[model samples]
Target: MKKDLRFLVVDDFSTMRRIVKNLLHDLGYANVQEADDGKTALPLLQAEPFDVLITDWNMPGMPGLDLLKAVRSDPKLAKMPVLMLTAEAKRDQIVEAAKAGVNGYVIKPFTAQVLAEKLEKILAPAA
Candidate 1:
């Protein structure tokens, strides 16, 4: 993955967001923005250009799956890469996200290596 890729990390918990930010930084991806929930994230997505979206599956206003659906539905944002970084690990939920068009999915408690591999897998197609 390119280090310059702009990333939007959306999660309800500040700590989780921070952790993800730190991990991204460690991986040399510095151009990262954040939102606490999908509701907060949607406007940013519409307003700015992001190379990828990293979102949680559960949140107060609009969960990740719903946000993923919204992104897919929007004409401008339809092709944006989305990685579901969440704890929603049920097989059905994973299938749902895949059907909704998520580029990648990582369960919570993930390692940096795993995240890196997933990013590479998704970005490679476009690279």
Candidate 2:
């Protein structure tokens, strides 16, 4: 993963956002931003350029899935990499995210190593 790449961490809980931000910082990604929910996140996404998006699934309004769909549908943001870091671990939910074009998915309570691995996988060039 590019150390300088901009990241957007979206979650409803402030503590969760801070935890994710801290993890990313530990992983050597310093340029990070936070959004409380997808409704708030959408505009930032549209207004700015973010290399990666790490979002939770259960937000009050717009949720992560809807945000992913919106990003996929928008021509400008269509190619953006989205990594779902959510507590929702249902098989169907994972399948739906994959079908919707998520670059990666990590269930909550993930370790820093898991996050690093997922980032590497998503950012890796196609073989």
For 31-107, candidate 1 gives per-residue lDDT tens digits of 99999999999999999989999999999989999999999999999999999999997999999999999999999
Q: Which ten residues in a row have the lowest lDDT in candidate 2?
A: 118-127
Top TM-score hit: 1
> What's the lDDT for residue 69 in model 2?
97
lDDT of 2 by residue, 1-127 (tens): 4588899999999999999899889988899999989999999999998988999999998899999999999999998889999999899999999999999999989998999899888877621
Clashes of each: 0, 0
Model 1 is weakest, by summed lDDT over 10 consecutive residues, at 118-127
lDDT of each: 0.94, 0.92
Candidate 2 TM-score, true structure as reference? 0.95
Q: What TM-score do all the candidates reach, one by one?
A: 0.96, 0.95
